[model samples]
Target chain A: MSEDFYIVVIAVLLPLTAGMLVAQRNPYHALVIRGIVGAVAALVYALFGAADVALTEALVGTMLSITLYAIAVRSSMSLRLGLLAAAPCDPDEPTPEEPPLAQPLLKALRRALSRHYLRLEIVPYASPEALQFALEKKEIHATCIAVTEALTPATAQSAASAPYHLSVRLPRLLEIVQNGVPPTLASVSLYRSRQMTTANLSDSPDARHNIWENQP
Target chain B: MNGILIAMTLALLIPIYEAWQDEDIWQTMLAFASIATKTSIMILVVSVLRDDWMIGLVGVLILSVGNASLMLLAHVLRRMNEL
Candidate 1:
């Protein structure tokens, strides 16, 4: 009984680390715990006299799989945000002023995205048209522009309250930005291009930039 | 020999517990590093007890190579934070 006691205890660690892996909420955290699990599992295998199995578990299971999955998770779990490049204030200087409130909004976005284990990637477009075009083309997951850019005579009063406007293409992203971002900083909305509008270019000029206000 | 393995197992629990509760990613990473090293060492001890050359060789390989995964993961994680 004493001879086999250590084996039983070591084998129990396999399931314990696995439970920790499953309990982990963050993908990156889960990946690290998975490395722990693999190590423990290899030890268990080796203890049972399965040296080949242990070797395979340590090399292919822990190292190769974790690296590949890290790449996959890093690439897939990120939010790509397109913004208008700050226009040069002076022709000679050519130094563009960062958009007003861009810093605060970005900070809030980073905080929000971090909670979800998502990275925020900023892509700058030369103009509002380009920003909107990228959204329509699915080039970016979302676009943030000054509210003034999208304002028409009718919405000029109501939209003026918010300096910046964020238009997200995906519904889930819209929800995340809406819930995570504060109302004072930017107004979040869903912008789904009308299927017919894309098919027919003769649609009204503002047809492309339709910003459906999803005010909570 | 059994007493030493038991003691090592007890020591292993410390890092596992640290990993379970710590909020910081780096702290959890530290726990992983500790756990990886400890497990490899435990394997080495087990190999010696059994007098199994194959298991001993496997333990040496793991001791050397297991940490490579940790370093690769750390680089990737550090890059994630910088961006």
Candidate 2:
């Protein structure tokens, strides 16, 4: 009788705690708490000589629910992107209130990927060589570097070409570049974060361009 | 029986307090697992006292499969976090 009483006490206490845990705001913890409650309920049934019930509870309640909960949590988070750009901002264009280093493509990313919480990190690479090395090593998600003119305003319109040429490494960014968004849209301050990468509308890219452009 | 009950109560309290205070994904899952284990044990005890094989069988099921889901979910969460 005493043993039975103790089992009963344990049974009650377990669910009570499970219930409390379930009440938490975090779904992750709640899912785990539900598993605990399920296990305890199964235990209570087994103590009462109902192995069949216990078996079903063990099979259904504890395992399946936790996995489902995990999938749900996994599906809900945002994507992470690494960008590197070095494009000259067209002085004639009106500047926006974004950080000084914000490139046109960066602004485009903020607009395009706004629905999901996009964690766009600007990885700094010293030269195009270093940038390419980082991208090859999978350090940066994508990279953009100045193709034609360096940051020398002294040689400005004199030896300048008619159109600007940029190159993009990642597929998702191709759409923003193809939209003909000029390199002039610069808001991100260099002092605000770090350096930048700019790759856009460059025609001389390799085979990777054809496949990624069509990925959609 | 009473001692077991006390132990279970303490077990429950830890999860409840931890869940309330900590927001970590790992700790939360662990707490839930602990609660599920204790509950299944209680069910097994109940099935024995009732002397009903059907009831006992239910306990068997829970003992066997109850924690599987939580484990699976934990694995998924861990993988997703890696991304």
Candidate 3:
């Protein structure tokens, strides 16, 4: 047979054989057969000086087909459940406000006193100096600032003699103050006990102690 | 097999159209016919041997890739010859 005849024959037969082997439920054997055919075809093409055609056949004929068959087999056996459960859910409803346990110390004081005193408010001032001024002027009863703010020299000096008390840290205080309720009991217990003076106070007294004791 | 027959018929018709228009594109059309004929024959043989539909489906993919490569090679050759 002519070199062209042989090349044409192999090209036609290899894929047919591989597809048949796959249909017979033996992809591993098919893969081996396909690989050998691909390598032989590549060698034959190289000898005949048809390098480009050989390369394409080797990739698409053997490698790609084998990989695809492997993936199909694996997928058939163990289909992924992740894709089925990937749909998004509707957003949850907004919760209503409760009391001191649900709100921040500052917000709790504002809400608790707001009924008796009409214009009671809790504003989050960036500068502790402003918060100190408000506290001194009795404009705001309590303030909630970050632990980092309390560490500043000016804040420390001002808070030393002032009637102002360092409320629990924002994250810990958030637990008690969530859903727009003030944490007055937690703050009062925290301030009155004075057992621990660090800025890392938790929303609950127990949680605050846990934070202090386990300073991670 | 169906896709290959369709492509081969199209390939055969292209040369006739080029010949009718007196266009210089008949040679290119002839090259397409050669590759399409070979692919069509291969598809027919595989479809008969297997007695399955998937063989015809795979024949479509193979024919597409084969014809595209042949066209690219012809284009490159034409450019080289022109140069």
Candidate 4:
């Protein structure tokens, strides 16, 4: 069975080549490639008439390891925070030193979060509504809006007195907000984000006939 | 059998080449899995030719559990990086 030998050799090399390609690109995706290697080994086992071994490899190597890897990847943290900016209603006020805003508080937060094992990425959303939409879509972990009765968009006139509304879904972040943001000047407001529903006909492109009928 | 064994032996070079070329831990794990799979299959073949299913069962065990433990180790290392 020289032809069988050739087939076995080909089976071994194919997955090895493919695994090398995928692993070289991203280690994250390599978890999937590892399963492929396992399946190939199972195929080889089956070819040699080791049926029990083949079944075990297929079940344990190809399936279980991949599932564990997927879960592990999901558990890792990559925080995306939203900062919504609103334009000041006044423009004629004389320029003084820039409003401190929440920069100092956020700096302290960065250090504190590092100690707690988290990465803080500040993403600026154009408007409060956009930020709100992103929060609802779960595109962002949390959103903060400035209630600065400001002189300019860059800095509030009285940053010390500037009140901010914070909305968050993550428990660790909620804990950070409770302890981190200056409570005297900052008012943290917690609100549940609205999840999108497939039952809404008005949300669909073809069905704009009625909006009130679908309210639930 | 000698020719078949040589083919499997040559398969070992792929991972050595891969490990030399890539520094990423996941890549290294993937290479190890690939190499383990190859070696396990070789063991299976040997056991089958010798008419001894016992050694083949051991090969099966490695084929099934080796990648999983390696993957678990990789995941732990990743979580450690986060912590």
Chain A fold similarity by TM-score, each prediction: 0.82, 0.39, 0.26, 0.42
User: Which candidate should be chosen as best, given DockQ against the real structure?
Assistant: 1
Computed on C-alpha atoms, the DockQ of candidate 3 is 0.02
lDDT of 2 by residue, A77-151 (tens): 332333223333334544322223435556665565443333344444334444444444555555443324333
Q: Chain B TM-score in candidate 1, rounded to 2 decimals?
A: 0.96
On lDDT, the stronger of 2 and 3 is 2
lDDT (Cα, tens digit) per residue for candidate 2, span B1-83: 46655666576667656655676767776666665665655555555655656665555555456555665776777775554
Off by over 4 Å in 1: A88-101, A151-158, A195-216
Over the stretch A27-113, how does candidate 3's per-residue lDDT look in tens digits? 333333444344434434433445456556645764566456644533332201000011122234122112122234445544543
Tens-place lDDT per residue, model 1, B1-83, is 77889889999999999988888889988998999999999999988887888999999999876899999999999988876
Clashes by residue pair, model 3: A100-A182, A102-A177, A103-A177, A103-A181, A103-A182, A103-A183, A108-A182
Q: After superposition, how far is residue A128 of candidate 2 from its true place, in Å?
A: 16
Q: In model 4 chain B, where is the ten-residue run with the lowest total lDDT? A: B74-83
- Give me the overall lDDT of model 3: 0.39
Per-model B-chain TM-score? 0.96, 0.78, 0.47, 0.87
Model 4, residue pairs in steric clash:
none
DockQ of 4: 0.07
Once fitted onto the true fold, the runs of candidate 4 whose alpha carbons sit more than 4 angstroms away are: A1-56, A59-80, A83-124, A136-139, A144-167, A176-216, B1-24, B27-31, B44-48, B51-83
Q: What is model 3's native contact fraction?
A: 0.00
True contacts kept of each: 0.74, 0.94, 0.00, 0.00
User: How high is the CA lDDT of each candidate model?
Assistant: 0.81, 0.51, 0.39, 0.59
